[model samples]
Target: MAPSSNLLNTQIDDIVKTVLEDATGDVYMVNPSRDAIEDFVSVATADDDDLPTVHMLADERTLKDVMDDFIVASNAADLIDAGRLELRTIEEAPENSLLVTDDAVVAIVHAADRVGGLVADDEEFVSATVETYAGRWDDAEPFSLRTPPITRVRNTLSEEISPEAEDDFTTILGSLETARGDGDGLDEVTISLLFAARNEALLYDISKWGEDVGIASKATFSRTKTKLEDMGLIDTEKVPIDVGRPRLRLKIGDERLADADNGQLATVAQSMLN
Candidate 1:
């Protein structure tokens, strides 16, 4: 296959901006990175009611930085905030690069080193790619409520717990569990909630953790979150984004849990259980 003479002269970023700006109904992308999606995010969030719904599919390794960039872009008011944007991870590497809007297939990123691939409006290729994208979208998890990355949490725990004794280690974990527990016990729902807050996940993700743990249904996640709030175990703060209302971020409310040291278990248990 031969490259388009026109694409040889075009810059990658410019092509991305053009594709995103030209989108009307929806946007479908495969194997996108932070730099690849920057312009698309800007164009998608520009309008309030009319923003195109975006669905991105990529390998698990790339999802973290993509999510980080989305967070930053949403904060900067460059994308729609009403959950219009969604992401999913695929186990297999994409066979071909694709960027599709409702109207056309704007770009294909074939090789990592190449500046660009075929950029065209071939009717057959666009139709086939769009069909492929729809299947991937249906199977992807909701990034808003997706599990917090294990690597991020591991890094945090490693920094805090190194050079510690067995007793101190027990105390740190015990304190966290006690803070999330009530007079009854630390059930799965409670434990899951604590895990999310300890990792400083957003409220959306915390609720999903409940569902992931089989807490009756998705609605129960919200009820569980409210229960935690009422118990003074967790707190929420609104972070402004591009559209609708600001997103709520979850945090551990108890100082005993935050401190995570000797005597923390007793301190939190007394307040939380009593």
Candidate 2:
């Protein structure tokens, strides 16, 4: 899509790129919806080194919605730590969504099912909009995201475990955008089990590592493991440890999963899941 199109044919990504292309300094995004935030963040972070800093002010509910998606939340946290993005939470829902730069303002328009943008460069309108949102940004409380950066997760997993496991992790993440609770896709726990089965890793080790890295709880991992096993996507063997209970080692239970590569594991698993 052309960045110049600001009519009904334009989407959020087009507007974001158009505004960022001419941005002089920091850009302020006011009250973008969850979908708008996803589009903006994906575009901004794709080549963040050249883009100006972005300050986003959204309501608590929107912030929470972004945080619930693992991919966006992790990427946003990475950008926040790198000083490329800033986030703040407002109390009430906003009436308008806007992208404000020093000299121009892009008003995001939502009509029925279509979305577009209107760029305004008039000094009076730009100044008023910037000033109003600048005050709101100053007063809004900072929103914190607890999800670890995906880069760190991948790096630490490679260092702490086998490279094969990390490879599977990366491939699984690449296969989907969100990690959990979208209803149409597999969740993090399911992904973890599939990767563990791919590597024939001990359930205790994978679950422990997952918990330590804040992916999910061990009990949740156990439940997910049982569910996958029942679905025939994963099978486990009792590994006799000279300790409390014999730990289970995960393996691919079906020929389809066993033959699929790391990149295809998530797709194969999702098909089985459905």
Candidate 3:
């Protein structure tokens, strides 16, 4: 890619890749979109040999958007834990987005139809951009993410519980990514209940596992289970226990749910929810 003072009509991911490829040291990103950050992390994580440290300053809203999605949040957390990424938040973000590196400075351009960027390699421009954003990076507040690494969650679920549950959990995550809205998407707890229902697992066992893994509290899982039951998506049957109350075994309630495969379960449940 040639150095351009003017915006080029190209994909944001491509521009990010080009700029990152030329970077000599650490990079600074100013107010990148969720998609841009995803692209950046994808490139950074893919390259095992040279993982340059990335300093990101984004708005609180954009950070929340990233954190709300299980897959994105978990991936970002993994990078942070590995010291490959540093994420921070600001109260208000500047109008333009930028990626500053020793090699060049790329200004992210948002068009009505697509995203683009302007790459500048002039010494003075690159130096000034770096100085300004580096200062902002120092002043910004660091973001603390609570989501666990996805690899850990997947491995633990498969090891501690059943592999079938882990597979269903992954399928539901894929579905939720393309789902319409926040309310329309099934959350972590709901997905856990769906997994338990699919496997006919005991509620106490799944909820306890969830709490232990830092996914959610047992009470939270119970509430979601009740909500799912009321929505006719799942049914619970009592199993006799030697001690106090009987344990509940989860099962698919609706005929549609029972018939749907793991891939279609989230879609069917979302339709029912709507």
Candidate 4:
């Protein structure tokens, strides 16, 4: 018999509600960002003393932006950290966002946009999805190593050195931006700037000085900086630039970049940013 489309839609809706609304059991997800996943967990386990253990397998490319979002928002960080959420990164991302209970009684696979997908209890489908997840799990790496170094308390700035330096750096940035079409333009620009830099730390501070040198905006530069930091392609340290306050220095990933040749480093940069 042909099933009623209306009935099927209702059932699917119910399944999604159950998976997101219920405040019991573990939750697992695959997403490029924390967009809806965070809310899913928060709503699922609200008011419970023992919250569900949440596990996320996300794309490595989005790891920096994700971490930056968490760092910028204290509430999000608190919720995830308090829930003891375990995070890992995979180079390839899933086509949909997944939410599975520990008991495997309910599994919801939403779209990458977090808008829709199947929410089912079918044992075979659930089992198959779990198996695919296991494979991804093997390829994933811990999120801790990819987290940004800066904290909320640390007052960081990207103050451009001087008017003379800005003019020279602006010209350099324009030339490098010509390579933008091949990969992540901002990211490639950031990497190229750091790579071609003679100084150990490039003072092209994103927050404070990016606009002066043709960077689109503070947010754009900050995001690129975070991604570089997360990929272990860059590092941040507070240098005592004056008597009053030390400035945050963004430099190349010395441990990796030190021994690497320009060609080799550029290849890696392209791989990461592209």
Candidate 5:
């Protein structure tokens, strides 16, 4: 959201993409500056708790520089193609250049865990690491210091989530909406409808809930409604609009279950504007 005169319009889909691309950070803010957006994306993805391996890769050169140049190859791709990076023989590795094999380079790079300093002479380290991996014992299972990496948080959510939960949630939301359209149907009609809404609206109620789930009684609906009202996830009002009248009417919230019906997205949006 920006000043009407800004003329820079971005879609919610684009904002969501930014959130996914840079997960777990600020999704929206007052100003959508480029630097701010990038920083938000970076920080959202960055783990503050995973502190820098202070002593892990600390060496003559900072790990950032080594990882940046050697590991990530951040140099200009065109310049690299031009052989701008010349291989000057370091005192460490003479006969065996560090650039011997990609696998060898990886082995040497990983050996930092076994080393003392944060950074080491790249030339010598690469050659030694290569030589270490080539020995016959590399095939030995126990000799391998490297274990499978700790699964990153990204991996867990990456698994294909069974759409069952999604569908069930959708169904619950749909039921709430259908009930809203079915306003004032039966005297206690709102009771069953609101119950369905509670069963699926908030994640807690619906997390373990399954589709075609059991129906809720008016009493159960009361409990769930209180919870929903407390969270402000939904609004329920029992009021007598006309003066001196004692009739109870139920009005739904802005976030009704009908919001998820994709076919009516445009229709809903149009209604909202009106």
Candidate 6:
């Protein structure tokens, strides 16, 4: 296919912007296929550029993609080594090519300003460092992954948060991302009090979740329970064993939220700090 001069120019502009004030040496740009990475790494260091560098990566999370990417990179190793490609240039770039630096995030916000991406949408898990690389299309579904809203705290939670709780929230999200559904996740008071109220997913008349995980009040607990209900992650009518009245029993959603989570995980993994 003929290169779309317009599209190519725009992408080049974006990539160049990524090489801000860092000490100039060599830089490498990579897309998320192992074959592309290997191919790039092979000829990459020798290619004419303002910088001499090798960027190596192919995001094949699945066994098959991994194998394919590895094959090409390995085959081309001789080419890369001969070029004296700077190891720094060869830093791993996941196929997503996501780079999440404060600068990158700001750039994304600025470019997407027209799209109303301005809303406070950073996940607790996403650092100020922000970068995005193209996601590989799945051979099966041909879909790209994304960081979902639930994982990120709205700007409302950004302020007055203790560093400790912030750390707490971040850790929980990390676990939640990998913890497979028992097909049976629970929204206990601990979840309702901290993440819900703090992240503004739920607004209780009173939110002291950061202080107590057990949750001492019934009235306030009920309010947040309803909030989770609105989100559809929990059922309000379960549990006859311990309560005279129907108590809100927390539960995970079937697939929608889970899919959302996976998307976000992809973004986070891709955006990891090198």
Which should have the higher lDDT, number 2 or number 4?
2
Q: Which stretches of candidate 1 lie over 4 Å from their true place?
A: 1-6, 43-51, 69-73, 76-80, 110-114, 145-274
Cα shift from native, residue 18, model 2 (Å) = 2.1
Count: clashes, candidate 3: 0
Summarize candidate 4's per-residue lDDT along 16-45 as a digit string, tens digits. Answer: 345534525555667634545435433433
Q: Model 3: clashing residue pairs?
A: none
TM-score of 1: 0.43
Per-residue lDDT for 45-160 in model 3, tens only? 66766656889998888888767766677777778878878989966677788888876887898879877787788888888878888888888898888878777778888987
Name the TM-score of candidate 5: 0.19
Predicted structure with the largest lDDT when compared to the true one: 2
The regions of model 6 sitting more than 4 angstroms off are 1-24, 34-158, 176-194, 197-227, 230-274
TM-scores for all predictions: 0.43, 0.89, 0.89, 0.40, 0.19, 0.22
Native RMSD of candidate 1 (Å): 15.6
Q: Go through the candidates in order and give each one's C-alpha lDDT.
A: 0.55, 0.82, 0.81, 0.49, 0.28, 0.33
Quick one: how many clashes does candidate 1 have? 1
User: Which order, best to worst by lDDT?
Assistant: 2, 3, 1, 4, 6, 5
**Tens-place lDDT digits, model 5, residues 100-188:** 22211211111322211011225566456545534422332221111111121112212322344334333333333222222211111
**lDDT for model 3:** 0.81
lDDT of 4: 0.49
Q: Which stretches of candidate 2 lie over 4 Å from their true place?
A: 1-8, 112-114, 242-244
Alpha-carbon deviation at 98 in model 2, angstroms: 0.5
* RMSD of each predicted structure: 15.6, 2.8, 2.6, 14.2, 21.3, 20.2
**TM-score of model 3 vs. true structure:** 0.89
Q: What is the lDDT of candidate 6?
A: 0.33
